[model samples]
Target: MAAGRAEETTLARLPGYLTHVALSFVKPDLIYQGGLDLSATGLQYPYSGTVLKEAIALLKARQPQLRVLLSVGGATYHGWDRLDEAALARLVRDLGADGVDIDFEPTDPRCVPVDGRMRCADDALSIDIARRLRAALPRPHVISAAGWSVGAYGEGAFADAPPRSPWRGAMLALLRSPAAEGLDLVSIMSYDAGPSYRPDQAFRAYRAIWKGPLALGFAVLPPANGGPRATIESTAATLSAVLADPKAGAMLYALRDVPPGPPGPDNPDYRSLATLICVTLDKPGCDVPMP
Candidate 1:
């Protein structure tokens, strides 16, 4: 429901409903300058390189349960020291993406509370960059991680906020250790991190440190450096209390964003929070339209 941006192509006019389309930044200096410019990726698709793989082959020839992922350190995450790993697994196997979304927001190990709990600083190089990008792209090819909406504040009852962030626990020091078994899902950018964020307690503090599938991040603009985000009736009351647990879902930092600020409900875009996440994931169309 979230994993927004990828220019939201909205998949070119809300293609029914998205499954996973995260084509944001691949910055780490373009995976240490091994390749890609794609003739400057789209702002709103005027077309680029081989017509951008012919619009990703007309979007998997029309949403064959779309899965395109190629994001890396997007919206944040400075540098996790280094992760070349065969040039980011050869740019996710030369842009035929379906994996890699490690949005690790590292700036320099901060989160220090020590004795009272919470302590961080690279946590073993962020769990060895999620176990070296899942051993350089293995299993089904997906690795998500955009978490850090107050990295589930200092444990023990999420130890009450305010810890002077540098992405505080930085995705709770890589999904509370064991490198989160190299992830399969995690998206919690829960809007600007001010106005006291509480997207269902940042999804119950990252579902108390990763338990597989989890999304819950939404923001169709508003919060460059101004607090208070998430509207549309608090994103439908936090996606109906976090998707009523059917392996919850929702992540929208962009879907052709620009929905303005100050209680973001002027609604001129982001198709009313992607039709309120297609009527809270009842799925099927949810009145698609909006080109």
Candidate 2:
């Protein structure tokens, strides 16, 4: 699964290896408030029917195997008690997307309610959202979540790892809960981990909790100049690790971050990374000429 934050047309521009492409976000506020905002004004990136349709159609034509999902929630929070499952279902149908991805990050300051309530801290709320989405969407649709890195839960960290926080059990609650059984993928955001850790270590931390297929999330770009991150070579190694495990998967941070040009001398890292994903995953167009 690739968290696709670029223009939908970006799908057409790249060689396709992604089994799933999650559109960056659709706002928890909209889902929780009632319905699609429709208006372009208040939203950060307003929904665009034309862009979506073109992106969906192009991807289908270019790579029939790829599944698209509307990712909801990020670093923002309004006082939405719950998501409108019916509306989400309708949107899924309208956009021809296969499913939804829950990306609620409670620890972020944005998720904190204005009233200083702990609603975002409620573990059951995340599970409830997942359950509702599973029930509302038809069968065979994908449901995934961008989960916290194991370090956030104090499970894995290196000597130089970023500041650590206790798991607080919210993320674990989602994974260990019965609701997770319906989940197709739980991508552990493995970036920003201590530099010494291997991808398998991060993968294991989540696997220990979430009883489902797991995707190790990695970053194409490092977060800061000196923090832990994967190079092109390390990324290839991680992808190989994912291939060796039956229950494992790999998720790149975003498609847009890759250089627009073909993977080559100027953009060798992106090209090599993309090639590894395409060939390793056996996606269509891998054998075709690089775009």
Leading candidate by TM-score: 2
After superposition, which runs of candidate 2 have C-alpha atoms over 4 Å from their true positions? 1-8, 31-47, 77-82, 108-120, 151-163, 167-170, 196-198, 258-271, 280-291
Whole-model lDDT for model 1 versus the true structure? Answer: 0.68
Candidate 1: which stretches are off by over 4 Å?
1-15, 22-58, 63-67, 70-84, 87-95, 103-118, 121-124, 127-144, 148-152, 155-168, 172-186, 189-199, 203-236, 240-276, 281-284, 287-291
Span of ten consecutive residues with least summed lDDT in model 1: 40-49
Error of 2 at 267 (Å): 8.1
lDDT of each: 0.68, 0.62
- Model 1 compared with the native: what TM-score? 0.34
Clashing pairs for model 2 are: none
> Per-residue lDDT of 1-291 in model 2, one digit per residue for the tens?
222432434555545566787776665545422233334212333335545555677777777878888887765643236567777666677667789888876654222222322223566687888888899985798888888664324332322233333332236657767988878888877766555555676566666666677888767665554555565666767777767667777787765466444555334444455666666665566765433
lDDT of 1 by residue, 1-291 (tens): 222333444443347477787767665444333344443222124444334444455677777677777777764535557556566666566656678788877666577767766767767776887888888888888888887788767767777755346666566667777878878888888777777667787787778768888988877777776776666777887888977677889877776656644334644357678777778778887785645
Candidate 2, residue 42: the lDDT equals 20
